[model samples]
Target: MIRKKLNLFLVSLWSVWMLQSCGNPPLVDSTDLVIYGGTSAAITAAVQAKKMGKSVIIVSPDKHLGGLTSGGLGWSDTGKKEVIGGLSREFYQRVYDKYQQENAWKWEAKSDFGNKGQGTPALDGEFKTMWIFEPHVAEEVYEEWIAELGIEVLRDEWLDRETGVTVENGKITAIRTLSGKEFKGKMFMDATYEGDLMAAAGVSYHVGREANSVYSEEWNGVQTGVYHHRHHFQVLDQPIDPYWIPGDPSSGLLPRISAEHPGIKGEGDDKVQAYCFRMCMSNHPDNRIPFPRPANYDSTQYELLVRIFDAGWDEWFDKFDLIPNRKTDTNNHGPFSSDNIGMNYDYPEASYERRKEIIQEHRDYQSGLLYFVQNDPRIPEKTQIAFKEWGLAKDEFVDNDHWPHQIYVREARRMIGTYVMTENELLQKWPTPQSVGMGSYTIDSHNIQRYVDENGHVQNEGDIGVPLPGPYEIAYGSLIPKKEECSNLVVPVAVSASHIAFGSIRMEPVFMILGQSATTAAMMALDQGIAVQDLSYTSLRERLLADGQVLTMEDRIIAK
Candidate 1:
């Protein structure tokens, strides 16, 4: 304990020294726009602002450019491609232009990039498939945008958040980091998944699942009876008894099942969505990097998975979604997949070191999972052999031990903005106003937690997979806070969505689309010298339409 405290003191001292060494960008009183986050949306928004002749700076915690789009979420969820326009479309067109080059494909022949070039129906369109790509490729596209616009970027600088600085009046007077460097701007956009800037700015947001009663949302909170997919291995005869003693667990606790029973159908709980690393896996014999057992490996933790393997649950392909370059953006599916739920409760609000520990725990759990799938004797020989051939991709995310630096944070603190998009809005009860983009994916939420059922069996809950009737417009109002909340601020990724409604619209493509729209709004607000909320809807709507944004499905622009 003494040594630990001394080490902590030393580390704090070192941090201070490093901050002083890094120095600060000249303290400016204001800029035309200041965007926070290194998300794809942040980049797109900055590019849009630059295009509109607005001086913009991106304050990011990331060393790289795009977030998930380049961070192993290559199997993109582009819901309504036709509605994606403006700078978002420009990004894909750039992807197409890259493939047009003869040297882009090293192993695969250029001409052979043919028929499959159309890509997934939901993901790709006539322009190109920017959705499915290698990490470096996506980063390059973003870097090009930065180069073209010459936008200033501050990398690896985290927001001090709790005590760094404050915004006064309609204008932000000072914004400081833990490092004590300050940034001030006229307009700020929190284009982050975590909503760090929003939280710091005192914006109201919720961090967990809301009750079904809250917004009359059909698919919210615990959902045990609804077996949306064949994720559970319970169907296998002699189902893995969710008990510690094989039958009697006055003995103790089981591997994955909690002692608590699955919660009520419509009850609200402090359950944030699950998180997992999007393993960039490959089967290429020469390029394959075998999944290594993590430093703190624990085989006992994987006993449930071993049971599933014993049962004839052979479809390893269930959670293995594909990506470019012979790799997969493997995801969690069913009750027991990669989502280490019930484990990340403190992530959104935790301190930096605690968050690191959580990240390591997830990494250890998932890596151990891969190792078990490949080498464990309990696994079917057929499954084992197939798994052995696949391993983490070699050429991706080299800095973070070949693992994607970010997790697929399915849901986090959602801001309750002026226009809270409820299920009613997306379900088409009321038409969305000022469509910046459109979304049509099913309101999908992965399992939130696993617990023992009343029947004394383990079950997963909070996994909803309901399809939307059709594409619906995402309102411009959703992206901006109420004028009184923060006049110059715009939120894209953490836009106003009720817990369940955000499930469909929170795709990377939608984030990118909204980022472009948010930036457009930022630049427009600057041009007209008005708050984002005070902008004339007629003029803003017209500009968005002219830029090819799908404001509404119906071809009515001026709402005449």
Candidate 2:
């Protein structure tokens, strides 16, 4: 009886503490637009909405803004800079403005920073654009823009998926956060990597790769044999043993190797491309933090890596992509790197606490792998020494202990909107509809699963890196749900697209462009009092072109 009373008292105290932490629920307020993400898209959307004479608030699930841009993805994956215009190009130009100052270069000399980038110069003096930047600098730019726009951003306000979204006659009237703060809005934009808002708002979405036959496209599904990138195992050189005891099936498969078949080629499955945190490493000793030995560090987890190294795979520093100063945006490379393949299949629809657990596991796996490569004697001495020279940049992600807060969620819940952007549309075989933005990046996807091959050797599957013929326009319909299911929401980041097509449209710059377009449509909808789908393409096109959005190529524009 005494113990029961003590438990009740403790529970009562905890409930009171939780209520205090969340703060008193704000009086229900209304805005013209409520963007439901703190990503680069969300920031740009809020700015656009504010500029278009609409009162807007950013209800962000993240504490920090700019998502991957402010994360360690400083090595921008820009396909063609000519296609990037309006707010997207403005973002890069702002990055240039920041780096143009003399004090921006702290760790290294400006001249030492040679003009190197993906298909363009790192710093374009004529265009006033800086593609490569530090994570902190990108975050600073986002904050500066929000402050300048006087846009209110409610950080750490997680959306309540259950009983929080109030819908009236197929429209979302208001959305309440997990903390009980309600935000009512006339229009909404779901700019999250995971389409949490869209999913909860009764919008249909897909979570995995669609079969090639589903969209009648060539590269849309389970690609077991297509190894476009160098992420697969060096199986051509030698068949690495999948089992602990070579050629023994009863001995069980090695760690990180899946036991299930990789599924039929060109068939759909729930597997998603691997996710990894882009590590910002620095060679400068003063600004480098040595890879800490993660708690529960198990060297045995990396036995597969040992086998990979033995097979002459020495491309460890292949993706230590240089950004700014002395920092490098280190990402997954080789067969066994930062990508936690086949681990995040459930992350798209996972509960918040469950997602946290998954994030911690990824953190442990990455940190342990780093520690193993640098400190383990089993690793080649030369490789170990080379890895030891690089460490996490001390100046970046300071709040998260120099670790990137955002994980690279390559693909998640892609909303199945009015017009699904498929590989056919991206490859230009089928004509794309009503252009809102352009995506020029390659149809790139990281490895999905590390499975044992038919030869009984471990092989990585589903690593596609097919470059597109040219830049393609993304449709406005891809951002809006079917007219019956939520009429007010616009999903930019997780736009309606097949897995392969999303691989191209999922770049950060494209998200910013789509965000601007979505908000523009939202403002128009507010003024005219109509559904987003009901907006005419002619008017939307004129407005977008007026705002300096590159809707089409120069020849296409002339032809039209």
Candidate 3:
């Protein structure tokens, strides 16, 4: 009896220990660097740090690895492929290598898919790089790369924004997550879309558009009348009424149409650019999942889309960009497409719970729009038939109920670092100093708000797409915070830039490039026992060049 009682007690103790161990895992030790994001930039930064033999950890808020890159944005927005060098270029080359295998093309044959992209071949034979890919493929690359490097990634670990960061004497010592797990590090990088780490560290940043006067930028602030893209009411055959009752002033405004007067054209506002899921959709019947009606499906939410269809607009599939395996990287197209305008203005600074609500609202809005188009009797029969052909890619984002795991956060809290990149730098009006990387994509910002115009017609504002003259160098100072604000931190994803400038700089390849550059600076600073802001640009430039990073257009030309 005594022996049995002792055995039982031992078993119970072991069980309790196991439970405790599972509940509270062993804490991660202090590392050389701690990256707070699951973005492509974060992955690249980790890879660079590991390459340079630094202990690093990626505390990701996301369950998945890549932010938008693996989150359905398969059709890459690579501006100048030549300028994309280093690990960023290596990533595309790996994609190319992946396609060489017969197993990579599961849904479609490699030979059948045409080689075309935005002014470049989707499959570039000369460069041995593949620009377009599938979501799962990108995720696979990131995962395999991380695993190969043996880099540590802690997923679903959100930083405690309010009181997480422990900063002393202008440098962060550690950051605690919501789960109460503390991460200590000598250096830190905020590669998040929201710049959560940067914000928590008391770094200076901007939320929305800056006035043209503030930065002497031509394309900054509230652009009310400017409609560069087809995402405006100007595309409609006739002016649509904003009111629920056609022309009645007393009648309340229609759903999704804002009644607020859009501010002056050049004036600044707190509104940020819209966000949506870059859905990876498939038309292949065998691999497609029918669009599921959202839990909060409201038919009235898409009344404007009905009006748009009635106005002879039928280009619903305009942005269903093709990728490998008969999939599409579908983006916001028409006036009432996937871009949830004005709904995500508060996402940058919202609490974790509030952000979840916003993300769900956007998911519902986009999902309802999809279901509404295919099932609604009000939609054109032919259009409904066309829309019914495409559905969510069943194999992609399988963990998230066939929906994308990430929302395309187009713009968010941009760090105001040592040097703020403005439109002047982008347009070559003023020279950008300390070239760490380069961005050649056109300056692009999606619609901010849908409001009643001066003519009393419903229209979209803040959608600007100004073409850049050519490839321009990104300043290294943009990555480091002001020395007084924080000494050990670097922000690559949300680098210091004006709203108009961020429009051009905010691209995946650019993010990856900046990530590598930022990590190099951080690692180099660690070696010299200096702050990232104090690191010599000449030394940084030499290392970057040696690593195959194209810092200038002239370098690109020379490489060619």
My TM-score estimates for the predictions, one after another, are 0.91, 0.94, 0.95
How close to the true structure is residue 425 of candidate 3, measured as C-alpha lDDT? 91
Clashing pairs in 2: none
- Reference-based lDDT, residue 164, model 3: 95
Candidate 1 local accuracy as lDDT? 0.76
Residue 153 displacement (Å), model 3: 0.9
Ranking by TM-score: 3, 2, 1
Writing each residue's lDDT as its tens digit, candidate 3 over 1-560 gives 99999999999989878877887665556799999999999999999999999999999999899899999888899987889999999999988999989998888888999877877899988888899999888999999999999999999998999999999999999999999989999999999999999999999999998989998888999998798999998898899888888888688888888888888889899999999999999999899999998887999999988888899997888998999888899999988899999999899999999999999999999999999998999999998998899999999988889898999999989999999999999999989899999999999999999998877778999999999899999999999999999999999999999999999999999999999999999999999999998899999999999998999987783335
Cα error of candidate 3 at position 352, Å: 0.1
What is the full ranking by lDDT, best candidate first? 3, 2, 1
> What do the candidate models score in CA lDDT, each in turn?
0.76, 0.90, 0.92
What does candidate 1's lDDT look like per residue over 1-560, in tens digits? Answer: 99999999999989877876797343345778888899999998898888788888898888887888888886667665666677776887777666566666654554433323223442344556455566667788889879977899999888898886577775555677776667778888898888888878877788887888888777776676876656554545545667657778687666656777667888788778788888788777766789998888878888777666666666677767655556777887644678897888788777777878988889889898888778788878887877888988877888877888887777777888878887777788777776777876778777777776666666677677776777888888888877666788889998889778888888887888899888887788888888888777787778877877776666322212
Can you write out model 2's per-residue Cα lDDT over 1-560, one digit (the tens) per residue?
99999999999989877886797653456799999998999988998898898899999999999999999899999888888888888899999999989999999999998768999899987678899999999999999999998999999999999887888999999999998789999998899999999999999999999989998988878998888988887534887898989899899888899999899999999879999999899999899999999979999899999988877877889898898788998889888999999889999999999889888899999999999999888888889888888898999999999999999889999999999998888888878999998889999888999999888888998888887888899999999999999888899999999999999899999999999999999889878999998998899998988887888775122211
Highest lDDT: give the candidate number: 3
For candidate 3, list the clashing residue pairs, or say none: none
Best by the TM-score measure: 3
